[model samples]
Target: MRTQTTPPAAPPVRATGRPGRALPLAAVLLAVFVVPMSISGTAVALPGIGADTQAGLAPLQWVVNAFNVAFACFTLVWGSVADIVGRVRAFAAGAAVYAVASAASALATDVLWLDGARALAGIGGAAIFSCGAAIIATAFDGPARARAFALFGTVAGVGVALGPSLAGLLVQGLGWRWVFAVHAAALLLVLLAVPAVAGAVPADGGSGARLDLPGSALFVVAMVLLTTAIVQGSQWGWVSPGVLGLFAAALAVLAVFAVVEDRREHPMLDLSVLRDRRFVGLCLVPVAASFGFVTLLSHLPSYLTAAAGRDTAAAGLIMLLLTAPVLICPMLAAKLVTRGIPALTLIHVSLGCLVVGDLALTLFSPDVKILAVALPMLVTGAGMGLSAGLVDGQALELIDPAKAGMAAGFLNTLRLGSEAIAVAVYGSALATALGTRVDNGIGDHAGASHADLVAARAAGGDLARAAELSGAVDTEGFVRFLARSYDSAFHTVLWGLAAVCAVLCAVIAVLLRGGSGRNSRPAPAGNSPGDRGV
Candidate 1:
């Protein structure tokens, strides 16, 4: 016993997970950053692409549209697929796919090739977002989980905020192709860290459940039809047979998908998730953002440049005030929660900001050069920022960890779907308002009314084009008239959007109430409340 007791060393304890979390966290955050950046990054390079590829507006638009449409349709699909395979595996596969597509985009010689590559990239982006959120959910817990998601939202918001400027710099310095080339390189680096990421994530290996191919296909089809209808409704006319048919088809497919999921032994989506009022309310937080925040992100710059008489640089700078909160508010909300501020309370405050901010935005005086909209812009941006990840983090906490990917996917689907719907609604409503007010006196002009053509052009902020399209002899007077019409239309739409947000805010409040006072907290995951299909 006395010999410096070299007692048998305890059997080596096998490590159950990676020794550290930093690598995996960094890897996932990098991938998440890349996807949203890609969504917004390529727009700045569009002019350069057109010049190089000899493409017209129709083809050029597809460069952006293909990505958005594909991304919107595939997120839910990828979410379901992630659970079927493994989150890490699906995430790695998506990164690989994204890298390849991005590289292909760089090497493309024509708009068609670029569009195809971008569409492929969108598919990969869907996987990355759905799986990435799930990975965070699995790898982190408690306060760490909340903080990790806060970073997740911050990075995504930063990507969206910086994409245009960063791409513009690259385009000016290197060329448009480098924009995608850089993404390819970055993703490749992310791929290199896959081993570390895999180790950190507990192996939630596949349950050997076969995918619901029929349900997946029908869901994809439904998303396609709905998104396509919204995207094209303005061009085709909302009441046109083509648009109406697409809307009807989407509803029918969705109904079929519901029926299929209801009957399937292993369905892709747990339909009950939709039935959970609190979860549905959580998902709609992003929808509020769609009308109150995203619509401004897309259209506000045009108002500043065309109506406020700001230069592009000035408008871009002003837009920063709107996006800045997105970079900071996520963490602030998370911190508040840690300090015992109920997450639901913060969410309600955020919704109030959106409504108040949208109403305050109407203070813009068409004749004043001052941006009276600054405080309102900040308030609106703060609304978006506070909920960016709070909604997601809370929603995931409510779901079984095994189903986190699906929950993430559904959340993103609503987030993106709302954006598409909101922007389309805003665009069409503005154009229609402008059209109604534009000098209806030109109804006799060649073919359809010049007023209609000019209103559309003006709505697009192509004043020169609008003036030419109007065939007005006094181009200056016509341009002024067009600007005034746009200002009036924009103000009118702001009021309408504010009203819509107020109504939605009330609806969301009721849903969040869930028949219990302000307590919006969901039950723990083991006793998960939503669709338990798979």
Candidate 2:
């Protein structure tokens, strides 16, 4: 009996429609690499940046928050802009903006300057993700598109998975400034290769729709206000008037946005996509990952150092157990789908891994070894790895190719948006939980606010800062108290994340049930996915 194996996925064609098909994938991959790196990598550099600039915590926090805010808000706007201007043009413009902003970040003299530059980079990153995914969606079809998106997913996942480790290396060896400098260099290469990608697609890829100014403005304001409120809620006090006001303002703007979109001749967003229950449901895959995986990805290092009793290097290494699966799973998921596994089945499995793995991760404690938590970490990573590219590719297909940019933008908006929300929620919860524990241990005192600072610093793994803020007679005991308090908080948040992920997974399973309920797709004009899109 002969063994049967699935044939390899088809390769993406060049813009010139000839031999050498890797340019589009390579260029877009390079451009997108920096965006996620910036997202996950900057946290490692924050302390170094703060120390050098002597900036306070609030200003320092903006380095990451500002990037997230701009990235989340501008994706939809950039999606529309990409469709109007052409994907390659839009990608190049975004790369240019990112390059300049990164260069400015490398040269910044103060925290405020760095924050502004990082925000600018986020704006550029918004274009990179929305337009880059749109381009992939347009440039290939069938097996080839799956392969292209699989690689796309893998690169992004790996970028995020390894960002801190790589960024830490850079910060340690060459200083924090060099991290941004490296981003600037990588984006410049992407810019130079844009012509190759441009040639791979149709010149008239745009929908020729006039820009929707009112809708766009409203969306930016709404996302900015909403994400800002969430990011600052922990620091500013969640129930404070300012946070409440921002939430209210965001809601009002969104209400107006809905009305405006309903009335517009050409809305910025395509409402039909939103109305598609399947698309909306599938979009939450990333949202779930944000809570179950990314919250850990960005914050786990702190936990390992401060709570798990690991050193920085050991924490970074152990992180490999969680991130290693992402490197392999995108391709595995694609291969499975190509070989006839139902994508929905795989998604269900992935979500299960995230929730189940997170619950299992309750085993992680100060005395726990890597071998103890390894299985759960791998399971959680597999969950994220399976869905990262698969969900986006499947979700994008549900919409018309002409609206690929919008679809891509909206999908990622939920993705990156949920990431901001998840991280903020997780961080806030951990801080609050830790603060309460510390307050109980220390008892009532005039320096009540100082406990909050110590909790924040300790949870962030800044023991020096936490200690300095503590002003304790016995520093070692205080550190132990901080660690124990943080450990308790870590366990508490894990339970919450697991519960949230399980709920989301169940919801998504229902949404994606009955398989791809998407209307039958027409044959590609040139037998390519993004021909019309380009």
Candidate 3:
């Protein structure tokens, strides 16, 4: 007599219930939106925070970098934790932590306190971001997955697009603290609903399922050291003993992380994922976009308010031109993907827009036209919308569906790390260029000494302060000179970024071509349902 064979249980994606997935999707989208919104929104408030707290440029920068460091270091650990416990549990816990962190940030009386709170928020953000997409991926597949992921990306873009405008209103109407307070309140509401919306998923329970504590500790140490060195490099001098030592120490720690992961039964980062060219190419999307466009989101508002003499609200309005496409293009990309248009094609086209956008910014000048700023922003925003919409879904499709939480975490680690590095590199370059130009301008007309010029540059681009330091009688003329210097520095940065994006675009276009577009259609034989099972 023949015995009956049992098939393995269907993947958790099968358990998420199609007929009632909308509530969960909304919940996840709401959760994901908070992360980017908090990031970009806080950027708009930096100037106010600096002035109010009497903080210098370094502390202002730390407010941003601290969050990024925490987010980057802990993202993979959160991803692994989600897999060990449950995605729903992780999501709920993350929401609660994020809300509490926001409240702490709102109550902060000093820059250090705010920085610490923001870092705590980053820890929560890592959990929510890593698990949120995994929950959505578990709930949808094929065309539905494409649409869901596209919507997910779109929501994130909406947050990015709206961040400056919203922050401006909040800061102008209430105060900078209200920005943190409002998000905290909203997150509290979301936390109450997470239990019902996220439902549940299978949890792994075994020794191999345990968290990679050694790997996690090593990674955290390495990332914190790297980010600290990068952020402080300009202030400390790039070649200073302190800066060089930090970099060397970070490298050593990273080497140890690699060795630890290699010997582990289960690593925090599956190094094998690096072997997949398609995954690497998809990650390049965020790297290029963050380097080329996203880092500028925070700085541009400062430029509008300081250099152009606009108020916070006006600066925010001007940003809408750059941010609006983030809302529109992603929905369109989703429709195209549903109609069998390849995601790679959309991403490639978006990359070309990024190149054009950066080139346009390079050509802009305060003497010629102020409106020229919006044109490049529009193009770049379109690129952001189209590329950001697809990268998450396409990248995740290359990995096991059961590991979607970890996959999302890993992808974000690269993406956020790119943003952190871009901000550090670009900010340093801009400061160096601006300082030199300002010194030359001051020396030529203002008759200022090197000491006075140094003080002016250290004033963090405050023309009034710079003028006071130079004791310039023609204050208006001095401000214009400051503006011109800024324009020149911005042009230099944009030119270099444009070239990098153009080259990376060509490489990714080739990498994403033909048979490698595996996620463009349903899974093939090698990637059948059983292959994706836990």
Candidate 4:
């Protein structure tokens, strides 16, 4: 009998040169954008949603933070699962889940239900987000990959920039539910496209690898405790024993996680990656970007509505000027990179723009025109667009192809972690400053007649009220003092952000070490091994 011989399976074909791959890639990019857009867009609609549902401040905060916390915690797990289960299937599952959750959110009767739905959306978001770049990495190479990433980055930037504006429109026209309903529609589009793009890439064979469940558990505990402490410290009092206890627990859990990961095979995160200077820089770039980005996003609306005295709709519109360039800049940067501009140079320039933007806002006065505020915001958005993809691309470039999933997970984890910290810290700072100004103003009027104090208190100690009491007990000086105090507090926060941005820019510039000019050559092409993963 003739010996039967079976041909060995051919290597998995890359989609880089496939016809119409760009269309699917665009769909994938859209899916990624939906996650961030959903979160940011809902922010402007929060007050309206709360009022409609009769939710309190705590619940309102959860409506936003629940998604963020879940997304941050599960990012690595989802990435690892994608590597084991197959990227296409994992991504498709995420889309389906996200769509379901979004639909449920629209019908939610209570704040708790809405928050639960949002948390579910975050789980699905993690699955899609973790695998997004990996799909792009596998499907494109060289200059094509660079451009694809640029497009992807641009889409993300636009989604973020447009989120509040979209929310404003939706709330004005149909109500807040449409903000979520729209995502459900978008998720359906992604679901239909996944099969066409993924082709025959088999499920990953690493499912049997140890998952480091203990380490993951410990990490979750630590992150939760730490984030809660930071977020609640201002409201609860920083020195409160409860806050201190949570911090202590966070440290303990962190220590345990480190110990467990050190001993585990197939650690959820390969700590060894941190030793690479390039990787460290790449990770920090995004962290810094998130710090600056969240600070602006969280506080800008408040500034517009409260200090600038704009209505919700107008405030949302003004905020768009800051975000619009975020969408546009990535495409421009992609073109620049195709011409051989170094990623590091792009990052430095972006950081510089952030510094400049923050500084402008710090110096802004009540007399400043809306255009002046809008201009700085545009600059900031442009900077974010240029920097976002450059860091992701650079980070992937520094890692092995097999480790791309893990590396991406780590980067995302750091990004979200930075954002959480930024929101908590900056929110605390702004609240503290506002409180201090109000308290000082009240104390200065202590010698005023009982009637004046009663009147001031009833008016919420507003600046205008303080001015009204000017004659009650030599109150003109008190009014000027309070006005100056408010101005100082406002500038202090703005200038603080600017200073932070400046420091980040200086560090990145030194580490990146390149001039701003674009290179003339495109990235190398073909089935080049060096171009495989990043």
Candidate 5:
């Protein structure tokens, strides 16, 4: 008998119609923009929302964090679900849900209602975001894919940069509720784009994988507990039972998740991915970079307005300087990357700039000009742009194409998880620092009050003498003292973040060999088995 030989399967066909090709990319970009914009845009309106609804600081924190926590927890599951079911279907469902949730938020009567709506929005956002890169991956190949990724990055950068300034305008012109209402309009655009894209792509015909139910539950529990502890720890005290219990629960659940995933045949996250030294190194950059980036973004607006005593609108405009670099740098970075510049180099450069930016801001005195404040922001933005795409690209490079969905899911999960932790951790740090400064100022004033009382008593308790003694007290001193104290506290937090950025840069330097060296290896025939088109 003759020996039989079999040919390899052909590469999967890519959809090519104009509507089919363009719609998914448009939908994904729009959806991505909405998520960050919604958070940043509404930030300017928080005081108004709080006063209107009589919500406390804790509730206000949840208004922002609920969406982040939900999105972070559900991202991987939804990404996997999109791969299993069909990307178009998943995208549509998420868009619809997000739209409704935005409307619900606009109409919310109380903090609980608004928070629930935000959580639902997060679920919807996860579904859309989880599949975003995969959709781009499937739609374009090679250089086209790189360009698409760059364009997507640019859109995200613009949205984030514009969100706060836009919100400030809206809050001044319309009302706080309109911020949520605007998202509803954006969602409608996504809804229209989804069907156009779905029509072009072939339906997902592969076997639907089992939902990682146990893993999903544990991940959600871990994230919620971790976020809760960070946000509430300052209020409740770090060692309070509520905070400690939450932290303990988060760790225990996460530990269980690792063991469960390691043993499962169809794990949500492939543990082997972590073993890739190069990939692991790239991942750490995002964790550290995000922590530092968020620390600046979260606190800078308040610093500009309150510490600098600028008008809110002026502060919002100053924030634009920070965002402008995010928009501009990615296009430049993409060109450099394609010219065979190492991704690791870009990562290091970005982190280094972040450190410099944070240090600059920390050294900002009350007399520092707005331009001085804006300079650090520009440096930070460039760093962010350089590091933004490294994690996803590196993760995809390590895994087989068949496991692209899972890898994408895991990468997003890590990114979102890092973001959530960054916000919580940095927010706690700022709050603690500010509180201590305020307390010390109040303590120093106690003696001044005591001296005034003694002077009044020595005057035989005459009302005129008491008034004269009170007038003699240095009231302006207290105002200046409070301002100086706040400045010191703000600087302390920025310096701490600068230290974080330095550590991150060091870690990336140690772990990542130059991408240029890796690219010099000969290209494989056809697509590399591990390479997805995007």
Candidate 6:
């Protein structure tokens, strides 16, 4: 008689061969980290920039949107270029461009100059992000690949989580300019390290790769017009000809792109990716998650300042409760994936937790303790952690490895585009909620318009200014009314968005039940489970 025990599974092998193995990963992380850092940090510095430049709300909004618009429009183009020109070259060049732009931005005295610099920075960011993902994908495999992606994703989250707090310190210690200045210095270091760390890879440009100029033009025009309409809708009137026209133009351009892409021999955006439902589900993950995260980033700091009576730094610290999970959770999720747990299951659970977290936040009132305000954010943060690299990992898994850069670009486009729309949609929702309250509470209030109320809110609900515009008899009474109305709007939007996330989770859960599609299992480069992307 012999007693036999099964041996433990062997650890997955790591990919090797490069100028320096760790250099590629470091460059990727640096690129990923800086983009989100710049985006999120800028959010914190908006007030400071406004104070310094004496810019109005419209100009300040442009300062933020300029970066987004450029990032959204050109990311795909850069991704394609990365594949053709070589990842390292594209990445290093992008970092240099970003550094120069950051330096210029730091010196900007006027809002227009700052906005232009930010837009240039966004183009550079697009290059870094698109190439960075491809470099990581090509540089690693199996469990190591998962870990690399996890770290990459974690750094992105960490950048966002740390951005506000870090920016607060820089703005407080030095000035708003120092925020961009520090970024410039860091990027310069990345540039100097690039040559030594990034090994050469042959350009894949000879693969009959043709740039889809028409497709690119159409998409850029659509995105620019659509984003402009959404961002300005609350102030400009949603039904105004300008807003309506922009929407129409965007839709028409998108339709043309669809037709052009479908017919093109070498399409910029391969429509084939959309055939897989699971792949589409994975793409939606970032979009849905961002709606919650970006919404908070846009509003929570202001809420903490005006509603909770906290300073900028303290507000950012409080936000750590919501963002800290991002720092640690992705690695944990990767571990779970390595242990044979389904990534989709984790994703569903993550969204469920997010829904719960948002619902919990609705319980918060002006009188609620700080601890109460911070606790629910932990739940949302946890949800974010459990689903860290899931979206990007799954997305890469779905596409051709050679098109890694384009896949990354496409995925990010969806995420960033959703964020742009979410900001506007959320703003509109808040406006609607406030309007309902105003109509009911102060009927026929002189000079009261939806635009005025929203503008008042943008000004942190200044009672005196609102009173001056609306001709309210009692400034204090109006202030209190506005505060309550804003609070209600905040809760309503969160709850509504949470419900939407929950629905998305449900759909994904059903799609993933029993077994995930072909790419369900994580495997090394040579041993991928199936060619059919899940």
lDDT of 6 at 163: 81
True-structure RMSD for candidate 6: 7.5
What is candidate 2's lDDT per residue for 340-417, written digit by digit as tens? Answer: 676777878899999999999999889887898999999999999998788888887777766778889999999999
Per-residue accuracy of model 1 over 120-225 as CA lDDT, tens digit each: 9989999999999988877765556667788999999999889988999999999999999999999999999999888877666855688889998999999999
Ten residues in sequence with the least summed lDDT for candidate 1: 1-10
Pairs in clash, predicted candidate 3? none
- For model 4, residues 1-534, the per-residue Cα lDDT tens digits are 122222332332354444557567767888988988886787777888898899998988888878887788777776666666666667788889889999998888899999999989988887777778766655665666676777777777777777777788999899989989999999988888877657523333335565667877877778778877876786686779999999999999888887777666666666667766667766777766776666787667655544555576787777778777777788788778766676676777788888787777765564568876777888877777787765676676666555666677778878777887777777666656755665555556646434434333322325546555544355666555554555566677777777776776666666555433222244544444324433
- lDDT by residue (1-534, candidate 6, tens digit) is 122222332232233333445665675687789899888789778989999899998889888889999998888777777766677777888899999999999999999999999999999998888888777666655666667778888998888877867888899899999999998988988887776545523332324476778887887888888778877787778999989988998899889888887877666676776665677777777777766666776777666665555676677677778888888889988778777776777778788777788778887676678787677888878877777676677667656666677778887888788888877787788777767776676644544455455444534545446555666666566656666766777788888888877777777666555646333456543453221111
RMSDs, each prediction? 9.0, 6.9, 5.5, 6.8, 7.5, 7.5
TM-score for each model: 0.91, 0.91, 0.88, 0.84, 0.85, 0.88
lDDT of 5 by residue, 1-534 (tens): 222222232343354433435556677889888887886677778888898899987888788878887887787777767766777677778888899999999999898999999999989888776677666655654444555667777776677678887887888899889998999899999898876666545554423777677877777788788877866775687789999999999999989988887776666665766766666676677677676776566667666654565666776677777777888777776666666665556667888888887777665776787666778878877777766654455455555544556666677777777776676666666656655655444555533443324222221212233323434355555545545655677788777877877887777677675443233221332344223323
Worst 10 residues of 5 by lDDT: 454-463
Which residue runs does candidate 4 get wrong by more than 4 Å? 1-19, 200-208, 312-314, 370-375, 443-486, 506-534
Better of 1 and 3 by TM-score: 1
Which residue pairs of candidate 6 clash? Answer: none
lDDT of 1 at 410: 92
**Model 1, 299: alpha-carbon shift in Å?**
0.6
Superposed model 3: Cα runs more than 4 Å off: 1-12, 15-19, 44-61, 109-111, 200-208, 305-313, 370-375, 451-459, 513-515, 522-534
Query: Hey, what RMSD does candidate 5 come out at?
Result: 7.5
Candidate 5 residues lying further than 4 Å off, grouped into runs, are: 1-20, 199-203, 371-374, 446-473, 514-534
Which ranges of candidate 2 are over 4 A from the true structure? 1-19, 444-450, 463-475, 517-534
Winner on lDDT between 1 and 4 is 1
